[model samples]
Target: MFTPEVPFLRSSATPIPGRYVLVFDSAEQTESTSIGLRARAEEVPQILESEGYSLTEYFPRLGIAVVSSAAEQLDEFQARCASRRMPTRVVPEMVYHALSAVPTPQPTDSFEDTDQATWGLQAVGAVNSEYTGAGIKVAVLDTGFDLAHPDFTGRTVVSKSFVEGEDAQDGHGHGTHCIGTACGPRTLADGRGYGVASGSDIYAGKVLGSDGSGSDATILAGIDWALENECQVISMSLGADVQQVHPPYVTAGRRALELGSLIIAAAGNNAQRSQGNPGFVGAPANSPYVMAVGALDNTLSIADFSARTLPGRGGQVDTSGPGVAIYSSWPGAEKYNTISGTSMATPHVAGIAALLAEATGFRARELWAELVQEAKRLELFSVDVGSGLTQAPPPAEA
Candidate 1:
């Protein structure tokens, strides 16, 4: 089998229901990659080696950092890791971190999905494809959020923070952007926001804390929480460096599918284009059951930062979306902002999955198959955009 190996750091421990979080450089925020690569990722093996830890997983690309939910938790593990002197980050378990309210702007039409929006319109259609995800539960696992965003006013079902005992409201601003893309109020062009599943109830899990960083334990806990809630579809805007799955996290994803949940993860925002690297997809995003996604620009051109597959890979990216400077709701329902990343793109698929599940009345594998089979190939018509994106009517059922 493909047992991904990690250093002494435990891959995944107990399935603690919590938030899906990220641990990025607080100094490095999620912004459009107009220039250099914004969210840089790489394997953490160097750090582990320095820490005197042993690794044996088949996929070390899926490196994991040891973390504890308790205060001062994992101190020894961290110390061990610290001894390595490698740059490392820990994402708190995914959960919601509510931010102070941001004043809502009178709805604008800029964020609307246009016919020219290619992948963007398809996403709208995907959400409307089944139903508005009204009854079906959808989870957004990403960076911090803004609870005060007008789009999410009071619709957030459950907001929990696992960033080492942090609040569930968004602080990093990433969670809010992803949420807006997936299920925010339809208010973009003509008042339609970037949301795909307009009516679906969103549960914000701020796995990436205010600093946009988190540990593996936090991610596992967030997954566990989604399972406990029986979330129909989960959208993760975060990605890991390793190609293999995190020990327990991999198990958790499989378990989620077995329990009838579908996942949509980001293909990553690495500038493989500039690196002269061909095939480079992110982990967790690259996991077996995940619906890996890529990003595009306003003109429907693949985003320069979109992760690509090596030369021979048929479909490195399952689909693409309007990730370049995509505008969406921020936490605190306060204001509208622009951000980019496959992170922004993943939610678009999640919202679509929710709609598909509700409309088709299929869970997990069934829903996943439907989405994949139906995805328009991004490579099909560069003119039409990749995987042409998805368009589903509000699901027939929820």
Candidate 2:
């Protein structure tokens, strides 16, 4: 077996001791290694222990399968090489039905801009009958939303706020805007543009306070809530400055993925040319499993204020979206608001995922891989731009 001088993990949720992750010298090696999810946290040690391995880190909400950094295990797995992707597949309880494979969009004409119906081309061409977020439940982990918003006409089924002293009301307006971009009713008229996925159900996970800022504990709690709620798509339109990832954020993101939830976060807007350089990709967004997004201009150009990448070759960000003057629904009366940042760009993908999840029925890693594979790779401003824009690929021949 060829050992690459590093530990290995079957999945991101499996906790390993120390601030380390299982690393493969090459993508091919990662393909050679085995990856699986844990069916039950209780049986983790026994399953690995049957192989003389022990668990280091544990994310119960995600239901991860196996986690180890022991060099010998990695070597053994490498010897049993196979496809570019892992062969082993560990599974948790199939709590919810798998998203349907065929495209099944639930179209509506009179609802608010849940499908992002006002942005003209951006919303018009973004969805279709096969691409609406039909059965997927999205957890909007932000400030509380007005469940009575016309855009949210008949969309909300679950809502909980952890912003101590705050009720189910959106004072900051950030969460409402984020939810609208991801999924809302048919309010916009030009070309009938609205949210990218109109059929998706939004769970108002009020973590951020009325001021649009939240604590680490609140964010973590919201993650747990999403997992328990069986939400498939999670969109975080808020972010903090701080180039590196924090342990708490990493744990929460990994946990969300374990629960079969696709995680998306704003890459943050700090540009780094000022004193209060709040441009660094903050917590949760810094997590690997979470798709950290940057921003772009109308012509698919990188946003000037978008956060830049680190000084590493592979550290290039995951993707980018239209962040400049991009418009979407807000918390107030039937209306829309133009916003910027990876925050604005995040819902584009989140909405797209709802559409794709409605089409392909891919789980967390699967959805992420498809998103990247179907993305437009414009690595020009690798730092601030990340992986250019994200949009659906042209329809392939039947």
Candidate 3:
């Protein structure tokens, strides 16, 4: 009876069938309304099954369900929900990819200074911070991680793979690099550090596959898992190159913040601003509730491929980080490599968020605001770098 109008777009048509997430009012509403809503949700699986749609999973707390169906079925489903005033929404299942690795570098010990390998760590003052993110929990959702990577030998990591039959192992290398930057060891075997919040608990959720691609459903499931684990920080280095916000992600982000978890995403790597063509921020990250991060080079310049914020676009780049030719752990026996993208920039912020979480006990929006406040203000427009490059939190006063 208390159906609020949900803002979600309808799909026309596509060859392959995809998953759609239907959202209803929270199950924590008034008792009568909550009961009614739960009843309606319980009826959903049967209703969809009757209509030839398969229900994938349901989150009773958030009042959301994922179903695999065709566009035509989705249109009919939307109409039915509207008729009943269910206040439901259909989330698009678009393909999103890892934003970096334009040119893969071979693993080498050429860089004598380990700190020199990861310029991002130094850029964010990771060297000075005494806090190693100990006791803090961080979730990095991307390609599977390398379970046998030597650098992570003694670390405590919990991993799960959401990609149908795949295991949570980094065959693509992107997730391993991201984990290395966000929660890798304080000091590598060679004595040079390349991570922030090095001692934080690592949660690796493999949403993307070895091909470095995944759909919205896979990614959303990963978000659900991260929030369920009560991770203080969720780092997403993958996203669809779309200008508009995906409705389910917006809902998921709001729910995560409400539950004291912060989701950070890559702005995207599809821009050519200097060439008179600028790309807009990508989805999930483009959603207002999620923090959208861009890429900055060693010279403090925006990366040519980093997406930009534009007028009328719902999402804007929130902050920046060192993404150009940054070094970190790689998959296989190689051990390490350097790559670039807004994807690379994202983990820098996540690692820093972990440190801030450890220092201030701030959760959700407060944690987000704290990161923005301490960022090093650069002589650049807010659209390029919302509050400039992110900085590590300073030492607490006695």
Which numbered prediction scores highest in lDDT against the true structure?
3
Number of the top TM-score candidate? 3
> If both were scored by lDDT, which would come out higher, candidate 2 or candidate 3?
3
Q: Write the per-residue lDDT of candidate 1 for residues 1-398, one digit (tens) a residue.
A: 00112111111222334322222112222223211121132334454355554422112212233432342333454454356442234434432121111111223533454533333645346423436777888887766467656546567557777676678877667787778778876544545446777778777776776766665555555676777788888887765444444334444455567678877777765454434643356566555556677766655556556666422222256666656666676655357666566676677778778777777788988887787666655544432233556546433443
Cα-based TM-score, every candidate:
0.66, 0.67, 0.86
For model 1, the stretches where C-alpha displacement exceeds 4 angstroms are: 1-130, 154-156, 188-190, 272-275, 310-316, 332-334, 380-388, 393-398
lDDT of 2 by residue, 216-287 (tens): 445556777888888888887765555445444444566566568887887665563334342455545777
Candidate 2 clash figure, as a count: 24
Considering lDDT, where higher is better, how would the candidates rank from best to worst?
Answer: 3, 2, 1
Instruction: Report the lDDT of model 2 for residue 57.
Output: 36
* lDDT accuracy of residue 327 in candidate 1: 67
Residue 269, candidate 1: C-alpha displacement in angstroms = 1.0
Q: Which stretches of candidate 2 lie over 4 Å from their true place?
A: 1-129, 186-192, 272-279, 312-316, 393-398
Error of 2 at 149 (Å): 0.8
